[model samples]
Target: MALQHFAGRHDGNRPLVAADTVDDLLPDLVALRRDLHAHPELAFEEKRTAGIVAAALRLLGLEVHEGLAGTGVVGTLRHGDSARTVGLRADMDALPIAEQSRLGHASRYAGVHHGCGHDGHTAMLLGAARQLARTRRFDGTVHFIFQPAEEGRGGARVMVEQGLFERFPCDAVYALHNWPDLPLGHAQTRPGAIMAAADRFDIVLRGHGGHAAQPHRTPDVLLAASQLVVQLNTIVSRRIDPGESAVLSVTRVAGGSSHNVLPAEATLTGTVRSFDAGAQDLIEAALRDAAAGVALAHGVEADVTYHRYYPATVNSEAEAQLALEAAAAAGLQASVAPRPAFTSEDFAFLLRERPGAYLWLGQGGERALHHPCYDFNDDALPHGVRWFCAVAERALPMDASSPTARR
Candidate 1:
């Protein structure tokens, strides 16, 4: 079973029937996913989920490492002596949304649910690990990364900061998310930025408060905040290149407590999304300047806090091609994504350190992500597992001519 002897003998490109790949195991996976969905946990609070993941990986005979980034788990499987390794990641966090679905597996915990399909992601990866362990068809090592807190808490970023790759040291990494927008059983991704860089900015306008009838005696913080909001909307359109894509949305505004009196302070909070670093920088700068200018015009002070969170999720050209090939091998309809999504993913941080690709698995559901009625399509579980296994096999094939490192 030495890896060196297994060289030049990989069957990753051989297509496998998605249904047959996990025929007997499908029910177990669906049950596991449903169990996870029923007891969804929030970001960085996945102790129960991590335990399940660890126990499952241990049963599969993989080396399991726990407690990275709080509730993160990494399972390593090696077949041979090849230095080359590949990593497959899945987020294990739920959103703070109430369950609206009446499914039997609906969230048992109030005000918490797996509206993002992470429950499905976790079960699928576990299925892949089980199959990969049983089959042992590939050389090198495969790291099954169960990351927590991907929902704005930056768990992936924290994992990288804590040296995830330094310990596991993958040649390339890959991640996937179920997309309701695409048809079921389809895999879509593209080289370049697949998801936008997400940044949050908060602005507090402070001014003198007075009765509404004497508005002339006080600086209108509400007016200033409103003007800044309007200005932020124009940054992507007028400030940046027309060819580049960017978005700045004012999602929250808080001001006056009473109708007859002007508030002394107004707070504005929103998000910015962009694909390029230049665009991110441009938007951040624009936000600060716009806030300051409006505050000065209104004779008030603007305290601006622009915090850059996640980088754009960019895929290496070679790895993207490999993912597409792997998807095809898994018998899923694979295609290049026509456009990058505005939503941000913490997986962007992993791509920054290693060459990798992020893909969208089609669930073919009408409900959008984060929707109350959203549910992970159990039918897509086998497809995801097959795709992950194929990607690991292809990325770390027995041959020495694996894809070159991109990061």
Candidate 2:
């Protein structure tokens, strides 16, 4: 089947040789994606999803491994005797959202939905794996990493901490996420800081409790907590440099339940996003300082705990260029992102271990990610599969200038 013969809503110019097999595999790919979307699982509880992935890879005759980080799966395929290896990763977990859309493939399990497009991501990589396994066009090996928990649970970090790279070594790695805002068949990435680092803070303000009628007898913690929330917004605008990007949002706040008595303690929690170490440090410090300053002025004690979950996803220059080239070869419009996204990804952990790039594949929808009405656009399946295949072939070529090619 020719690449140009595959007719769909996203059909464009003829793609490269890597996409020749996609025409015959589109039905199976779409079916698999819909099935996965119907049965959504959250975080580390992807037992059924992981099992399906493992079974599919085994059917492809690739060496499969499971049970790393609870439900992570890795599939290895080798062709020629080249030691060069590349890793292609796809997240396999869903989000905690109720199905609001009436599509046939909408989530059957209430409050569990594939709203973030991981279903499509997994299917695209699987399509590429099947094609690459059948054709054996590349000289080196490819590792298909199906990670389980990408929705704030840090499943990629778990895989890395469990010796993922040491077990199956790779010279380079890559991942793609669906972007609903960009037009279909368009891809975008950059060489540095593709996503921001995510950090969360928990603050506690303690004061003496007293009857509401006699407010002057007790320090008011609720007042201090409210002031702290207002102060946190200043960390990004006033404290940090005007040129740098950062965000501090107060997501949750808790206080007393009694109407007659002032609360003795109040709790505040929120997240911090930054692209550089300087901004991250400044944000953390500012949070602690603001909490202490407010609590002290109110004659109360403040306790703050800051946790850094995922670091910034900074792509290497060489891998970013290679990915753009692969996108061009796959007949997709590609460009560099103007600024890093505030959303954070656990794949940053994998990039830290090995050089790689994470690009956004355009799916083109009005609904944003994590929205109840959002669904993975099926028309972009061929584009994602072909891009992954082309990137693998470009990274691990059959015969470059040397016997082994280093990505």
Candidate 3:
């Protein structure tokens, strides 16, 4: 469908775009979202999604730029000669999980799904882009950023590295994710560290392989790996400060293929989440120490590799307040988030470059993010669209002498 069909008529006297304005665009937005849901794309492979986004932006007469970070798209809208610019970002990637939903629009692909609601995020941002383009309610430039590879492929970081801000400079940027925990129409955010830093660790224990029946013939690499896992779990409790919050989970382990033989090697892989750099360092150090200790006790050689994937998502105080205010202005229930999520986001990389806030738009559902059964709540689309529009308007209000104001 042409995006122009979703545009609402602007009344000069209406100070802000009403919820009903977004409501009028809901059907098209929902269809677009479901289309995206059905054709789920992963990481930097969002060609189809990027094409759709670029086409919609072009239909709205926005300057469209694509191919940044391979499959990222940015649609720029400017008005009233204002130099100020604000970026509204939406991730355009799907998870690698199979869709369990039986909905008519469930993913057509076998092992991919929009389990995290990026489809809704992209649709809402597009809906806002359409509304803002039609209404010209804001004075400054608005860049609708459709980023790829947000699902652990580091799309945001890649965009920044490719000079995302340099080509389309934004004074401030904002992003949102749908939260299944909060009731629909509620929004939440805090000033600092809204999401934790994510780090990955992979450990390999190598020793001599021998018959399982021979008790003393081998170093028992699997035994050392098991012991390492136990000690790694204790790092947070015994090493990290009790006052701080962190999580260490052993998500995967691999060893022997048969019960009759002791494997020469065993490996452990997991993630570390924390909000503080000091704590991250301490945990990494303690993890290596524990692995070394366990390997020594079992007469195995331990090899440890730890990598920090994404930094903690910290929000600037002013931008965070503006985000909450935008939520309230959009007629949603806005409040400070009670606690930061342990989940990590690549948008953290964007925030590191520019002043911005990442928000959670409530979509209340039984299934949480990344769940196979989860789908983006169509009911929350209007709420999110309104919030995006309101944030753009609030960030770059029209001046008395502006063309939009005169109209």
Candidate 4:
């Protein structure tokens, strides 16, 4: 499982591609992808995974750096003499789900599984790094950013905070996520607001506890909180514009455990999702108002706290069109989507720093991401690698005369 094997049986002159261009690099991509699949790692804890990535980049003659935000790896493949740079990003984290892939090559970590298909993303980018380094058909630099903790901990933001852009500034940056619901070899994307802003709220309504037989003697916090949940639902369904899309799902609620006794306080927790700031603000306001109304109705004190998490994964129009063109050259049925996706991502941080597009690749009947039974489709690996290579070649065409040595 050395990096040598990842390069495959090669003479450097050996074609990583095929004559048709569409069906190229499948074997090598599969090998590397399977290797990563068997050994998955969790967010911000990808030490061995980092080592493997760094070694592969080094062997490909790219300048590699390790230890960013704990376990992020950045690989620089200089193709020509130009200051213009384009960065490609992949998240390197696994979830706390058990692996159901019975392949002799499943996750080694007992509780950690790459149900998110990050393993395939990492391998596809690595394949691009090697193939592009060998071909060098691009100008400027390609920074392969392997980030961690993308599954809720904001690892992309962490890298940005650590001067990822300042240290190796890029003119444009891009990222792609595998879409299980789409067909294979197809790429789907939208120009803006491709994903929603995800935020969570916790409300604890305090009231006097009393025996069940004498409910009127105490402020009934449970009843008040129950009403509040219904009121919160009315925020989106009744108050918010029907044209706009927003979700207020109360994912968790807890209070009393006894059968006959009333609890002193009842809690309500839920998430808010929206594509824009206006809708986000409106939802927050609606939640606060509903909680206040409920507390007043029951004469109970309410303590509400909201935590704003990842911003909406918005795609820059110009850059998104560029990615669409890349998919076009790669022979994908790429198009701008009608509606923005509601899933949030930390890559929104990267887009905030530079011009770039986040895209989706069809997973071809693959299991949904985060499913315990899911595994990345190996066939789609080559398609992803080709798209990566095609993106670099189009963005930064090679400078044959430039220095082509490992720096």
The TM-scores, one per candidate, come to 0.93, 0.94, 0.94, 0.92
For 194-231, candidate 4 gives per-residue lDDT tens digits of 88888999999999799988988999998998899889
* C-alpha-based local distance difference test score of model 1: 0.88
Better of 2 and 4 by TM-score: 2
For residues 1-407, what per-residue lDDT tens digits would candidate 3 score against the true structure?
55556543433323344334676778889989999999999999999999999988887778999999999999998877778899999999999999999999999999999999999999999998888876777778999999999988899999999999999999899999999999998999999999999999999999979999995989899888888888999999999999999999999999998989999999999999999999999999999999988988999999999999999999999889889998998899999998999999999999999999999999998999999999999999988888998888877878745432311
The superposed Cα distance between candidate 1 and the true structure at residue 403, in angstroms, equals 11
- Each model's lDDT comes to 0.88, 0.89, 0.90, 0.83
Report the poorest 10 consecutive residues by lDDT, candidate 3: 10-19
Runs in model 4 with CA error above 4 Å?
8-25, 398-407
How much is 308 displaced in model 1, in angstroms? 1.1
Runs in model 2 deviating more than 4 A are 1-19, 402-407
Q: What is the lDDT, from 0 to 100, of the residue 86 in candidate 4?
A: 89
- Cα deviation of 347 in candidate 1 (Å)? 0.5
- How good is model 1 by TM-score? 0.93
Residue 312 shift from truth in candidate 2, angstroms: 0.9
Please provide the root mean square deviation of candidate 4 (C-alpha atoms, Å): 4.0
Extract clashing residue pairs from model 3. Answer: none
Q: On residues 1-407, what C-alpha lDDT tens digit does candidate 2 reach at each position?
A: 12222222221212234447787888878888999999999999999889888888777777899999999999998878888899999999999999799999999999999999999999899888877776666888899999999999999999999999998898999999999878999999999999999999999999978898888999999999999989988889999999999989999999999889899999999999899998899889888899889988999999999999999999999999888888988899999988889999999999999999999999998989999989999999999998898889888897777433444
